[model samples]
Each structure stands twice: as structure tokens, then as C-alpha cells.
Target: MGENIDVVVIGGGYAGVMAANRLTRRDDVAVTVVNPRSVFVPRLRLHQLVGETHDAVVDYETVLAEGVRLVLDSATGIDAATRRVKLAEGGDIGYDYLVYATGSGSPSPRVPGAAEFGYPVATLEAARRLRSVLCDTPVSAPVTVVGAGPTGIETASELAERGRAVTLVCGGALGPYLHPRARRTARKYLARLGVSVIEGSDTTVTSVKRDAVELGDGRTVASQVTIWAAGFSVSGLAERSGLRADAAGRLLTDETLTSVDDERIVAAGDAAAPSDLPFRMGAYIAGCLGAHAADTVLSRIAGDEPAPVDLSFPAMCVSFGRRTAIFQLARKNDVAVPFYFTGAAGRKLKEFSCESSVEHLVNEARKPGSHHWPKAGKHRPVVLAAQRGESAAPAARDT
Candidate 1:
């Protein structure tokens, strides 16, 4: 190529786009982002398929920073020894600094036939397909959601509220990390909405077979649409690139978010597993780490010491529906401090929070490198004191 680019960001998700926009804002740096898609998928709001807010998203064309190049291709691997990224179609591009933010893919459901038949909302395409199937397919059709976390709960609730027969096959109680009361309350809400909650089922999804999912228990559910929302896995690109990855295949980084083997390489979002201070795969931490990664690269370029970044995060916000949510407050160290907000007012607060996060993305992307980050999340006095465990500790954030 002409010359090695300043920064090459992989995965055009929230973190990659934010970092590219920020890096290109400096005017002195040239940034290139590589991804397989044309648009930046708003993955967090994807569960509300039956609602208008379900389609919320920001196009990358409208927000990409100046002097930043967009390469439409999937990264097959990286030649870290030569500081080059191998693309599926756009060929090899060299870079001085690299940021991998490909995010995570939906973990394959383990129940028999789940892999072959389960529909997942992990990606924009998957969500779109699920939306189409639900809208066009038979109503009252049995739809089984095989997850109970934020995505699964929201999906099942949205489907059930819309008059669809939804069976939320929660592997655990709904909101397992939430306080006992919160979990009970969520279950009550779900039960009131005609959602069938199945808990403590040792589900082994063998594969997906058209319209039905077969569990290892030899039980079969006639689900016209089966969604797999259980866990996540990083793209194998990191492992293929010969980076220092962990057993789960996440790129291993230091407290400062630098690759353990190469300081010039940085990782954010689900693609990153920062040692001594790991973060969850939420967008909240991606924004923080994206900004931090940019700062680390900028400081190094300027021959200054890379400042240490504390994994300081406040809390997590989860939406149950359009008018209800749970703002789970945590400690400064990110343990749930038994805080909970619910009902209509809680829903409004959730709306405010989601809108504010969207606005921050737009503002920061529009300005490209304004060095803006979210202030810590505030909590209400109703902190659910009943929950003070390490599961709240998290497998742990835009993180």
C-alpha cells in the first residue's frame, strides 16, 4: 500500500466507530474502519421487535468522521508481526495502531436442534429476520425464547405483549443477578403479560431443525420461532491473528487496554478481556474503553506515558418494555448495591437514559474526538439491598 495507516479499527460496532471518529478528529491521524456491513447496528435496542423503538439505529454514513476511510469487508485475520490487517475482500492494510472491536456473537444454543433451528437476535440481520418472521408468520404460534437476560427477557416480553404465545425458557430465574424481589417482580410482570416462564431446565440444544427445537431432555416444543439468546462468543479473528487470547478466545489486554504482546494494538468492547480489570460486554463500557483506547494511542504517538485507566463504572440500565425498566445501581467497583427502580416512572427514567446515551453517541460522533464520556450512573434510594453477590460482580462493560 501507499503507507501504513495511523489506526485501523476492526468491527464497525459502537466501539470501533466511536474510536475511529475520535481518532480521525485530531486531523493529524488517518483512520480506517473495516467491517462486513454498511450500517452501524444499534444492537442494544434490538429486542423490541414489535415496537417502533425496535428499529432505532444510526447510519454509519451520517456519522463517520472526516479523514476516516471505511473499508467494507470482514477481517479474516491480522498480521501482527507486520502491523497489517488481512481483509476478506479489501486486501491487506497496514496500520501503526490497531483497535479490535468486532464485539461478540450469540452463543449457540445447546438444546438439541437449537443450533439448526433457533433464531437469535445477536446481530442486525438476525433481529431483522426474527422481526419479519414474527410479523408475517402465524400469530399465537409458540415462540420459545431460550434466554432470560436483558435480551431474552425483552424479546419474550415484547412477543408476549403483542399477543404471541411466548414461552421464555429461562435457564435461570428471570434477572438472575437482580435482587430476589426484583426477580420476583419481573417474573410477576411477565406472568401478568401471558408469558410462560420455564426455569431450572437443563437444556441441551443439539441443533435447529426448521420450526421446532429438540431439547436433550427428549422434550420437543413446537416453536414456530425459537430464539437463542444464551451467552456470546468472540469472532475467531482474534485467535487467528495470533494475538494473546484467553481460553474463551477474547483478546487479552492489560489494565490500560493494550494488547499484552503489542502495545500498538488495543481492544475494546467484547473483543477485549483486560486483565486485572476486566469489563462486561455492555455498550456503556465500550464507549469508555473506546475513548480510553484512543487516548492511549494518542498519548503513545505523542511520546508521552500512557495513563492508567481505572475500570470505573457506575451501574447498568435494563428495559423490560416501553413503559417499564430496571435501573440496577451498583457500587463504584460495580457490584449491585441492591438498588432498583420500577413501574411507569422507572420506565421514563429508562427512556431518558437510553435517549441520553443515543444523544451522547450522536454528539460525540458528530464532533469526533471531543474527549467526551458519560458521567457515572446515578441511583435511587430504593437500591435492592437483597442482591450483593459476585454474579453482580459479573463475568465483566462498551466495556
Candidate 2:
């Protein structure tokens, strides 16, 4: 056994990166991140697949703390009782602490052949697939996007800008988390870009076959390509490992973002569903939560009480294409209100969110004591190869 406890992190997304970057600030606790990938895939900018925003993929070697270790293996199961993670490979690694940040996967409703026929637009692999198809697929082709959340909106809008016949099928109000004004404004902006958004009391998608979507009201729309942009489903890692999970399979966390059953085992990003807040995972929250998770681990190692994590919702930018967009201002209790800004202004806000996430990671990695950033490593992909490739793109403009 090592003098300091080994902190094993699962999944290498925004939450895992932030957690790992913050956690290793102290010299006491050892950190190990197990993930299948090495690069910090910036998912928010993934909608650019319809466009040309490939510059968003981040390299983790520059952001991780000096001593943090990265392992490239797929985590198959978690043993909470023994504090050991069962890997798909031949080894079993034990951890003094565990952080579950497996994040979400593409959710498919029981809608006919949607699972088999639908083209995914969320995960990195899915985006890559979509990119390959889009680059080969003809412009003005019929692309059906289901779901009206942030991901759906970005995907549909960006696709429409490319002159594709985009039909966004929303089950409920568009951007339910966004304020009513913003929702209306978003609807209008989407329409302006030639996106046919179907939303009404009876508008619903019951099933989606390879060529068409069966609506709830017995209406059928031709969909050459269908994209599922529905809600997020927490990874099965925590659920299979016997950890306490809510209805959505997210690990139950306390106010400090650590698992309720185990103090050493914390959660971050989308995979962490704090019993108190029960967040609807986003990068804005993941980055902050990741930092806090790291801080808590470091404080424990220092024999000090970890600080409480308090996250409040503000506005988030929604890109409506390269030309049009909406700047939503979300209040404490309500959804984001529409600021009615588009073009460069809304794009600037979107860019700000990206910068804010990356900057927080860089600063917290350099200064561990400033604010609590947890040390969690979940992605063991290609980043461990030590490629210090700097961003060729301009510094993402801040808000």
C-alpha cells in the first residue's frame, strides 16, 4: 500500500479532466485517471461537425497537474466495497478513492428503429461519424433532428447553415430550460435559417424508421438522416458497481459533490447527480464541479475540511448557425431569458463559455490552492503520448 491513497478516476471528459487537474495540486494524494481516450474532447463545439470547427478538440497533457497519471484502458466495472475497479484488460487496480464521471451517452427512446437507424450527433465517435456522412452527403439533403435541447439546437442550426433541409422535431417546448422569451426567439431564429421546427400540442415523434419518422398524431415526415438529440443518460459504470443512483443512473452525491455512501468516492460532470441539486449536466457545471471535486480531495489529504460547492445557473449561449444565434440569460429559478442578440454577439458568448471552461482548467491546474479543483482522470486515450500541440486556432474570444 502506498503512503498516500490512490485516487482512481473513471471517464475522461470535461468533468474528469477538471477533477484530475485540480486534485493533483497537493503532493500528498496520488492520482490515476483511467480512460479509453487521451484528448479532452470538447463536446460543446461538436456541432461544428456540420461546419468546420474541428479546432475544439483539446489535448490534456497541457492541462493536467504535473504528477497526475493517465491510463489508457476501458473500465468495465467498479467494486465499491473493495475499492477496486475491474478493467476490461487483465489487471485489477485498487484505489483509496474513486470518482465516477463517466458522463452521459446518446439516449434512444423506444421509437421503432430509431436505435438502429438514427445517426448520433453527441458523442465524439458519433460526431465523427456524422462528419464523414455529411462531408460525403449532398447539400440540401433532408436531415431530421429529434430533440430541442442545446445539443439538438446547435446541431440542427449548424446543419441548416450548410444549406441542408433540416427538420428539428421537438417533443416539448423548445429549450425548456431557456426562458420563454429566449425560446420564442430561438424558434424564430431557427425558422429564419430555413429550419422546419415542428412544435405543438399534438406534434410528437412516436417512431423513426430509416426513411421516415412516425409522429404521435399519425403524421409521417421523410427523414433521410435522423439525429437523436434527446436527454442525457448517465453511464452504467456507477449503476453496475452497486453505487447509490437516482432514477437516471447518476451516482448520488452530497452537497460537496462526493458520493453519499463513500466520502473518498466522489462524482463530477454529468455523471454526478448531487442529491441536493440534481443538475442537468453541462460543461459550465462540469468544469466547476470538477474543480470542486478536486478541492475536496486535496483538502482531505491535507487533513482539512473540504469547501462546499455552490453552483448557480446563469445564461448560456446557443449558436443558431454561423450567421444567427441567441444570447440567453438564465435566472436562478427560471430558464435562460432571451437577450435577442445574434450574429457576432451571440457567437461571442458561445466562445466565452469555451474560454471560461479551458481557462479555469489551466489556472486551477497551475494554482491548486486558489480554488478547489479535484484531481480525477477518467480518459486514458491518446493524451498520454505527450504531444504538446498548441491550438492553431485563435484564443477563443471571451465574454
Candidate 3:
């Protein structure tokens, strides 16, 4: 018997939950997850919450391992030199190791009036606020959804399917991550839902106002409810703590998810920039990273070298309301291919993925070290080499 290792994981999103649960594998390690909310938020289904279709929250008891302690509070800063996490409320908690998995949120909008007038659905609180606002507004109100990313597309389509007049303002192409054919499919589906799909270089939102959104082309669209789904930004906790972070404020890490400056700290999910090249933000990747981060800590405790991250993307799925979706297949490198699944098939796959993301946490809670992900292909090394200005041969296939 020896002193138990205390590992504190900040944030209880997909990544944090997975990391906490997986860390419970060792009897000698104690895991504590710090989250602001008491319940787990199913972020992918947040649009459903705004549409009044789903609540988008799960009890922490259902997903968190019984051995893992759940701390209901936000982390304000990290005192890495003292190995302590400062809580927003008052005291700090010391940790032998720390997992920096604060996830992400809507960036502080810089567009004029956007911060004051626009509604973002990136967090549970934000989604609930938007849901309440939508409930109070008339169904006929014109809802303008900014950004053409998956969140924007889902929100617009969800509202439109609920009989609300919705306009999706895509600064550029719709579903920029999708193949051209897949993008066409998404556009067609949006049109079918009676959603006005606005696209093109000139369609960028210049400013958001109380009653309308101005466009780069000098056009103004009437908007009773303005939803900003443009993108996500990580918290400044790491940067505020004086840790090396990427330009996006994600903590800089090595290939093994260890902090570049301190091996005692690791990062996961959207808050981690491994090798200064982060994976695309999603629950699938987040869960894998969380599990890998746990393994890295366990390896260090056992005096073994932690293995580098080896995960690859298989596809990207975006829902159009509840009945339809587009599952765009991609290579291991995450570049979309020409093929895709849509209609009923895509919807089923998309729903399964959403469910499985949470189920991964629950399963990991019940059986630590049970989750597994696909290994990264040869593309990452070649890309890294090119970034370093070293010549490299092309990979035979990404997957």
C-alpha cells in the first residue's frame, strides 16, 4: 500500500469524463473531475434542446465512475508550479497529475453588436438560454443562423423543421468540410426544410443588430432571433496559468498529449493542441484523446514510456433536424471523399454516433481501459515532416 495518486481533470465534457473514468483503472490513483454543472451535457444534441425535442443533459451518476469524485465548480486557474488548481469559488486543490480538458465555448464575438445581440449555443447554459428565448418567440419569427458549420446547420434545420422561418447564413460554402457533392446534398436538404440557405464570399455577416444582420455585400436580413454557430474557442485557463498555448489558446502538447512545458500536465479534447496540430474538434476524437491521456498518466506512474497518439478520423456527420442527416466519409487524414450517406441511413448513423459518444463514457466508467480507437495512418508523420521543412514521401493511403 502507498499514497494514492490524485489526478484532477478540469471540465466534464466528453473528454474529461472519459479521462476520469479511465483513470479509475488503477486502485492506486484517485480521479476527481471538476465541472461547473451537476449533470452531463450532450453537446451534440444541443440543437435538439433549442428545438424542444431533447433536454440534452444526462445525470453525472450515469456516466461517471463511482470511484471518481465529481466536483461541482469551475476552475479559474492552474497553479502548475505548486501543482494546484484554483477554483472559481475559493480554495485550490492539489493534484499529483492534471488533465486539462476544459473543452470549448463560443468565442467572444468581435463582430459589431454580435456580442450584445447574437445568441450562441455552444454551451449548455447558452443552449438553455436560446431555448427559452425561442420558446417565448413566435414560430413565425425569422431566425437567422450564422456560420455554416455543423452546429449552425443543425440549429437552422432544427428550427425550420419546427415550423420556424430560418435562414442559414454561410459566410462561404455550406458544409465546408464536406465534399462538393455532399455539400450539394446538404444544400438540397436545407432547401427541402424550407430554410433559406445564404452562401458566398459576400454573405459573411458584417454585423449583428437587434432586428437584422448586415452582410458584407450591404444586404440586411431581418432576424427576430439571431443564433451564432460560427465556431468554438477554448478557455484561457492554460494561457492564464502561463502554460504554452497555441494561437487558439489550446494548451500546447507533444504527440503523447503531455504538456510541452510540464509532463505532469496533459490536455485533451478541443483544449489540446498536440504537436501544435490539433485534431478536428468532435466528441469522437475527444473521447479517444481522453482515454489516451489517462493511459499516458498511468504509464508514467508505472515508469513506462507513454505511447504517442494514434487516432484517425473515419467520417463527419451532421444532422438535418431529426429525420435526415449527411454522413460524409473521409480518409484517415480527415479529408472528405466523394462518397457519403444521406436520408434515413445518415440519420441512423448520426444518431448512433451521438448516443455512442456518451455510451463510451458510461462503458469506460463500468470497465476502465475497455475503449479503443483506430490507429493514425501515415499521413500525420508526413504532414509533420513537411511542417518542419523536411522532405517526405507520400503515404500510400491514409487509411
What is the descending lDDT order?
3, 2, 1
Q: Could you tell me which 10 consecutive residues in candidate 1 have the lowest summed lDDT?
A: 377-386
Q: Which stretches of candidate 2 lie over 4 Å from their true place?
A: 338-340, 371-399
Candidate 2 TM-score, C-alpha based: 0.88
Compared with the true structure, what per-residue lDDT tens digits does model 3 show for residues 226-308?
99999789999998999999999999998889998898999999999988889999999999999999999999989998887
- Global fold similarity of model 3 (TM-score): 0.97
User: Candidate 2's residue-wise lDDT over 169-259, tens digit each?
Assistant: 9887787777677787788889888999987656678888878987887889898888888766767777787777888888887656778
Worst 10 residues of 3 by lDDT: 390-399
lDDT of 2 at 393: 23
User: What lDDT score is found at residue 186 in candidate 3?
Assistant: 93
Q: How many residue pairs clash in each candidate?
A: 31, 22, 0
lDDT string, candidate 1, 140-219, tens digits: 78888887888888888777777788887766566666667677778888887788877765654445567776555676
lDDT of each: 0.73, 0.75, 0.93
What lDDT, from 0 to 1, does candidate 1 have? 0.73
